[model samples]
Target: MNKPEKIVAEDLSEAVTYPPEAFISREYAEAEPDKLWSKVWQQAGRVEELKAVGDYITYNICHDSILIVRDTPETLKAYHNVCTHRGRRLVGNNTGGGPKTVAQDKGAHSARGSQMKFGCNYHAWTFDLAGDAIYIPDKEDWQGALDNVCTSLTPVQVDTWGGWIWINMDLDAGPLREWLEPVASLIDPFEFEKMRYRFRYWGIFDCNWKVALEAFLEPYHVQGTHPQLIKYGDFYSFSKAFGFHGQTGFDSKAHRDAGTAVETSVHRAAGDGDPRTTIAQMQAEYWETIGASTSETLVKTAQRLPLELPEGTPAGEVHQYWMKIAKEADAARGVTWPDLSDAQVAAAGLALSIFPNVNFIPGPTFSLAYRVRPWGTDPDKCIFEAVALDRFGEGEEPETEWTFVEQDLDKWPYVIAQDISNMVEMQRGYKSRGFKGNLPNPWQERKVTNLHRGLAHFMGTGHLKRID
Candidate 1:
């Protein structure tokens, strides 16, 4: 409801700088687990994944593995995924339903109508959904060793907001709402909880986690990295950083006005043939040649854009026309459209970067979210996960699972592949002898600067000095 504090270009110019070593040093990667990862609350998964009473999902960050479960119809709980006896992972599969199992082959078992219990396969030690140690193999051998020990799966602070399950390793860490701050409140009206996961993807990137994350924080790189997008809209973006999170995107009016030229990919005057025809052609080529995935909602929305508005119609009026058409389409499909303000509607395609390691490009009907994290102690390696969420009509069933893809650029969707191509090269550049450190455009790349500032604060390194 209230406008958040803005971080303009001037604010960015005065912000701190970050060194190359932060992205390349193995020691820095190792230190993150304790300093940054453990202390902050990280999104584990969506509530849709664990909707039922015994449903559970496993989220691993650095060396910590957390198991989040639906304890009751209204309550959710999280615990360390380690066996109390030998530290074997309690759930090897990323997610599953019903009670946890000890059988190695039960990885794909669904939890429908099943009781909640977890038994470590290495030993028969078992625990309940509440993480209470219900049974231990050969208890007499320990001489009441388990009696005094607080053996319930080491509890991790867990909470849910906006349909996401978040976990904090530090018991005393701030609540999810507190950590998220204005960003949470800003997006709450979007009703993300009504969305469902359309797809999930994961890849092992050959670059540091920060390198991969920084790639999505701004649209400044779009002109060079995703040149094809220039045809559709202006690459110029307005960015705002509110403490640990920030967003960047072309406002709707700005986007429509900039897209008036024939040079713009998807914009054309009334006489330039049917707009839907051109859009369909471009969409087809995008999916086939560029290897980018397309969603039904995106295609339909773009297809409905009125190519021929009244001569000299204001951009705001044009955007309103589009929203009117979009709402009608949504209603026809049995989807409830959220009541949004003009600015919120303008931000349909805005991209957001939540501090630490989450980034997403939001849309009125769909969003593509990403989470990147360091893979162990390897500075040169990181795990990247992408989840596509969409608002579906009632009774629509969507399949959800991780689709592991080759880390090669050719295997990724066109937009993402372009970013990865740069990431690999940038990682190599950071290691070069002639390279110094990052020197970002204060206006266009301010989100990246804010990200580094947040990281530096979290790591207790103070502000990095400018190399120049």
Candidate 2:
């Protein structure tokens, strides 16, 4: 709608001293890894990860690699990923797990799965799929009380939503949904269950984790960090605030509406090369040229006559077709399209950066979701794993996995690459002598400040006492 005036340094100094750069330091990240990660909630994996019984995925959070297993369609569990005997990491392979008796094929499009048991690969310390230690290796090692004394793997508190499984390390912590209150409402309208996961692409950035996250929170940097996005994209105003558990940021309604329009420059290009006229003609040519979509409806409605098809057109089909046309228009003009499948887009292009270290991006037809785990208690360097979800009918599976594909590089390459890099650099910068202090841009960087404030509040630090 309107440009946000940059606040002068004098004005910023009186607001918040937590500079934008404070989020980019290694020392800051390492100082309270446990304090930051353990007390708050962390995302584990998606429900689709353990799609079948005994289907399990191992996740390594800060200082902990957990083994998550779906023992049955209804019963799911998470365990510490360490071996019971030799203490080696259990379930080293990505696809390693238990039997498939835990799930069932009730009907097409139905969410059902099952698993029987789990075992450590190091010394074969076996446990039920529910994390109960069932069997030990030795028979007469110490005494006759082995079976009575030995137990299953340690369990973590978990919660599920939109097909995702979230875990909290705090045993006495509040409920998962309570903590998610900050972002759940911001993203709940997408109804992510209907969409699927496409492939995820990740790169370590040159900045701190917060820097990478802050880059995504606002559209303010779209003019510079991603110049190409400004072509069909908007970067005028932003909505920023502190949610119950996380921070919230979004573009203005004008920006959202502006992005739907095709650029006038592209409209003029229609008749130049192929003798076509108007924006629609240019888009049609471009779509056909690149084998993309050019549905008349997806073109900015203000630019052309609205097409009214026969009543026989299915409502869902109409929307899909129009979306395809819009995507084709974007591709023809070199617009940065969300790298997701049709399923993800239908689900919603909206994403959720759940405070500490989880981001759930629901695309139009598919979704790109991931959880960042601290690397050996270092919050800067994280172990990132993304799950791409898509729904196939009964007896159907994707021929090739698309969740691991890296397709959004053109639009946000620098941001993704800069994330891990900044994490390490900031880790080092926290100890810098030249680092006087940080002064955050209140209007633009409110979410970053909100995040810092949340962390401080959760950890019982009085530094962010301004909120109180």
Q: What is the C-alpha lDDT of each candidate?
A: 0.69, 0.48
Instruction: Using TM-score, give the best candidate's number.
Output: 1
Q: How do all models score by TM-score?
A: 0.84, 0.64
The global Cα lDDT (0 to 1) of model 2 is 0.48
| Per-residue accuracy of model 1 over 243-317 as CA lDDT, tens digit each | 788867553334343222222212221123444444445555544543323346445565555454544554445
Candidate 2 lDDT over residue span 1-468, tens digit each: 111233323212235544333354445555555666666667665666676778876655444556677777787777776666667655553211111232332211112234476566667777777666677767467577555334556667777876677776677889987877746654455455544444444433333455445544544555655454344334444334436233323334443422211211112211122121233343454333321122232345213322533334443344444455656654565433445543323222223467766655443334445554444434444344445544333334343232232323443334343333334555567557787555555665555556666655455442332210
Which segments of model 1 are wrong by more than 4 Å? 1-10, 93-115, 251-295, 304-312, 346-349, 466-468
